[model samples]
Target: MKILILGAGQVGSSLAKYLGSDDENDITIIDKDEANLSSLQRHLDIKTVCGHASYPNILEEAGIKEMDMVIAVTKSDEGNMLACQMAHTLYQVDKKVARVRTAEYLHRKELFSDSAIPIDFIITPEGLVTDYIKRVVEEPGAEQVFEFENGLVQLVETRAYAGTPIVGHPIKELHEHLPKIHMRIVSLYRNGKAIPAYGDTVIKDGDRVYFVTKKSSVSKVLKEFRRLDKAYRNIIIAGGGHIGLNLAKHLEKNHRVRIIELDKERVIEIAE
Candidate 1:
């Protein structure tokens, strides 16, 4: 696959490092800084072009016509979207991926498809982080939560405390304790090291536990390891930015959520 990556920031460099090593991928990166390109060219097999990512001449100079996929991760949302649009419009690139963080652009997702923006994928880092934080907050005692199968199934992590019912019990006892719930103990870690998570594996106090189950049963499944965490009823979020506002809106349903923004104008705008 021939990939043309816009921007020479952390994401662009990391992508080049991973894809450049692959014998099957021919990676070309564009950036405004020659220093970033020089650093990449020194360590990777990928080609680097120096220029504004959204510029038509820059895209042409980077061989956009031959690229199988184009990835735009520039700092500016407008620049990234424009590069993807150009890649799709002029070159008819098969795949166009852009990292757009602005809340306004993401809210109107319909603009990206067809000939409008022509972006095949839109990566919203702010939205991703907000969802992750919300999951952690909603699932009491869960240190981390990840959804799978379109939110039907979830993998959760929590610590096994001494007071919990299944803390000192065998892994198999979890099923016996909650016969109706469908859950599986995926793994366990003790003293910063992985422990054998066999059926007879005993969950000890201070041990990190991982489990998988349906989203509906996640609360019940998590309680098996430890349930000492008091459910959060009141929350205060700082700032009125996209991430902060989104998180506040999601949590305000069941919890008393308040947001503090330093910008008075922004605060009034959001309040309305």
Candidate 2:
């Protein structure tokens, strides 16, 4: 795999360093700053190209046609979008990821409708971080939450609260309520280990619960347990990385989240 990353800044540099460590992937990092380029050249075996990567010519010079993945993490969204668009349209790169600040381009369908630009994925660091915080705050009991099929299928994570109403209850007993609810306790995550259990598996307090259910029935089942997780209305985040940006985009639609970052460059990138 060959990866072309624009901008030798923190994110791009980190990505390249990790990618270069993998023997299977070849990485090339392009940046407008010679000093930044030289700095990365010291630590990794990745190729470096010095230029303003927003220009299509720079991408071509970097052999974008041979690249398997193109990542645009430039300071400016316009630059990232342009690089990604060119990678998709002209070079036909297999994967194109552009780092955008506002997230409007990704959230808005009309933005990607343009014929000239065809970006496969748009990444928002600030938004991701915000969403993670929301999950932790709103469902402190749950380790993670994943919504599938456009939110139709829900996978919820929770730490079984001590003395939970469902504690010591067997799966067969819980199924008696719905009879046809179609609930599955796929795997148990306990003490950092994952174990597969059968229907006889007992629900234990403090055990991590991974439950899957139809989106509509999620609330009803949660209510049955009297809801042990935290319900966070406001969230305060300290950093605005890809995680923060992705979180805000995901949770802000349904919840309130705030992120704080002190770096001016990152702040500008996260701020619309």
Candidate 3:
């Protein structure tokens, strides 16, 4: 697959690293900074183009016409959207993904369509991060949680603590411990090394355990691995940025939330 990624900032560079590592993907990244391009070239086996990513000539230079997918992750939402529009209208690129941060543009659903902006997908980092934090908070003992199968199934990662009922016990014993609950241990990691999750394999303290279970039973499954934390009530956020504000809004309905920002103007705006 030939992928053209616009912008060489943190998200773009990180995507390049992952996509370039795959043997099948031919990745080319674009940015206005020569230094960032140079740094990326030395680290990854991918092509780099330096210019205004939204420009037609720049897209042509980056081989957008032949690209299987185009991802615009530039810092500016307008720039990203323009690049995606150009990719679709000028180059007829099939797959277009853009990172749109501002809610004003994102809230207007009519702007993103085949007849309008032509963005195939929109990636909202702030919204994704907020949802992730909400999942973590909901699952008291889980370090990471991923939902699949229309939210009916979930893959959860949590550390096996000493006080946990299942710690230092064989994997098969889970059935005996929680006879009513249904879960499966998929993998185990100890000291950054993969360990087979065999039925006879005993879970140990400090082991990073990965399991799959029904989403409705996630809380019950988690308690088997670690001590359940008390339900969160009072919360304090350090910044009133996009992520902080979104989190506060989500938690305000169920939990007491307060936000503190260094900028007085931003604080006052959030307070309102």
Candidate 4:
């Protein structure tokens, strides 16, 4: 795949490193810092263009027209958005992804439509991490939680302790134990090795089990694994930065959340 990446900061350099390592991908990176570009060019096989990322002439020089996808991760949110917009409007790039940090633009989703900015995907690093942490907190006892179908379904990882309902039984008995609840044991890991979960496969104690089930039945299914942790009704988080604020907003609806920040100005911002 041919790709054009904007910015050569940590995010851009890291992306170039991974993509350039793969022979199938052709990566071209843009940045205003000649030093940053030069350093990356030394280590990676990617082509480097030194200029303001959002500039029309610079984007053209970086071969945006012929590239398959464009990714904008410049420090300036406006620059990232504009580069993605131009990549779509002028170059007709099929995929345009921008690292947007500004919450104002993110709240107004209509701005990213084809009729507006034309960005195909938006990457908010803080927001993404916030949601992941939120899920881990919400789904107690789950070693890991992966959401799909807009959180309608969840793939959960939990340890099967001794005395847990089905720990000594075959996989087929899972449904027999809970006749009404529909659940599937997708995979199991025992003693650092993957154990294939089949109909006759027995779920042994100390096995790390992965299962897929409806979102609403998650807690109910968790009960069959081990004792569920008490639901988190009150949460106190340190700092009020992007991740903290975003987490508070998501949890405040159902959780009694309190934020402690030393910065008075940021506290006022959170109040807003």
lDDT of 4 by residue, 58-84 (tens): 999999989999999989999999998
Clashes of 4: 0
Count clashes in each candidate, considering only residues at least 3 apart in sequence or on different chains.
0, 22, 0, 0
Candidate 2 on 97-133: residue-level lDDT in tens?
Answer: 8888765565676676347466677777766655545
Give the alpha-carbon lDDT of every model.
0.89, 0.76, 0.92, 0.90
Superposed Cα deviation of residue 272, candidate 1 (Å): 5.2
**TM-score for each model:** 0.91, 0.74, 0.85, 0.91
List candidate 2 segments past 4 Å from native.
17-24, 33-39, 88-95, 131-141, 223-272
**CA deviation > 4 Å runs, candidate 4:** none
Error of 4 at 82 (Å): 0.9
* Candidate achieving the largest lDDT: 3
Show the lowest summed lDDT stretch of 10 residues, model 1.
220-229
- The regions of model 3 sitting more than 4 angstroms off are 22-25, 42-46, 108-110, 161-164, 167-169, 189-194, 204-207
TM-score-best of 1 and 2: 1
